[model samples]
Target: MLRNRVRELRARHGYSQTALANRVDVTRQTIGFIEKGEFSPSITLSLKLAKELQISVDELFWLEEDLDE
Candidate 1:
């Protein structure tokens, strides 16, 4: 499973979903879904988000333990 630290990062940066999405070049709904763990972004989009949030891609997402296979 894909997990994201979007909510935490967003809170840390004091950014709303819409603002974050705008900075990341995605829709606000996409950011909402990402924060809720309801959607996994493509690599390119993930990179975009990481750049916008001023963090590394690894910091934004990780594989769940059970999915280690």
Candidate 2:
């Protein structure tokens, strides 16, 4: 599964889901889904998220297990 520190980073940045969504030009539902691990962002969206969050994409996203390998 893909694991991310989106929620933690969002809190540290003092942003609500809607606020972050607006910054990333995505919907609040998209943020919620990503946070819940029910959805994964596309590369473009991921870059946008990383940029908005002031972090690297690698820092934001990772694999919880190397199951695919």
Candidate 3:
């Protein structure tokens, strides 16, 4: 499974789901799903999100097992 710190970073950047979604040209629900780990974004979308949140893609998303390392 893919895990992310999207919610935390979004909050730290003072952005609501709607706001972030707008910046990334996606829907608010998409942001919600991403935050909940119910969806995995495409590489293009991931790059856009990382750009908007001022972080790298690797910092934003990771594999579930990566946490065990």
Candidate 4:
């Protein structure tokens, strides 16, 4: 499974779901699903999110098994 710190980072950046979605050119529900771990964004989307959040993609997301490392 892919895990993300989208919610935390989004909050730290002071963006609402709609705000981030608009910046990322996705729907608010898409952001919601991503935050809830119900959706794994495409690489392009991930890059966009990381850019908007001013972080690296690796910092924003990781595989579930990576937690063991």
TM-scores, one per candidate: 0.88, 0.91, 0.92, 0.92
lDDT of 4 by residue, 1-69 (tens): 789999999999999999999999999999999999889999999999999999999999998864556
Off by over 4 Å in 2: 66-69
**How would you encode candidate 1's per-residue C-alpha lDDT over 23-66 as one tens digit per residue?**
87889999999988889899999999888888999988997865
Candidate 3, residues 1-69, lDDT tens digits: the string is 899999999999999999999999999999999999999999999999999999999999998764555
| Clashing residue pairs in candidate 1 (N, C-alpha, C atoms within 3 angstroms) | none
RMSD of each: 2.3, 2.1, 3.0, 3.0
Each model's backbone clash number = 0, 0, 0, 0
The global Cα lDDT (0 to 1) of model 3 is 0.96
Candidate 1 vs candidate 3, lDDT winner:
3
The segments of candidate 4 whose C-alpha lies over 4 angstroms from its true place after superposition are 66-69
C-alpha lDDT (0 to 100) for residue 31 of candidate 2: 99
- Candidate number with the higher TM-score (2 or 3): 3
Clashes of 4: 0
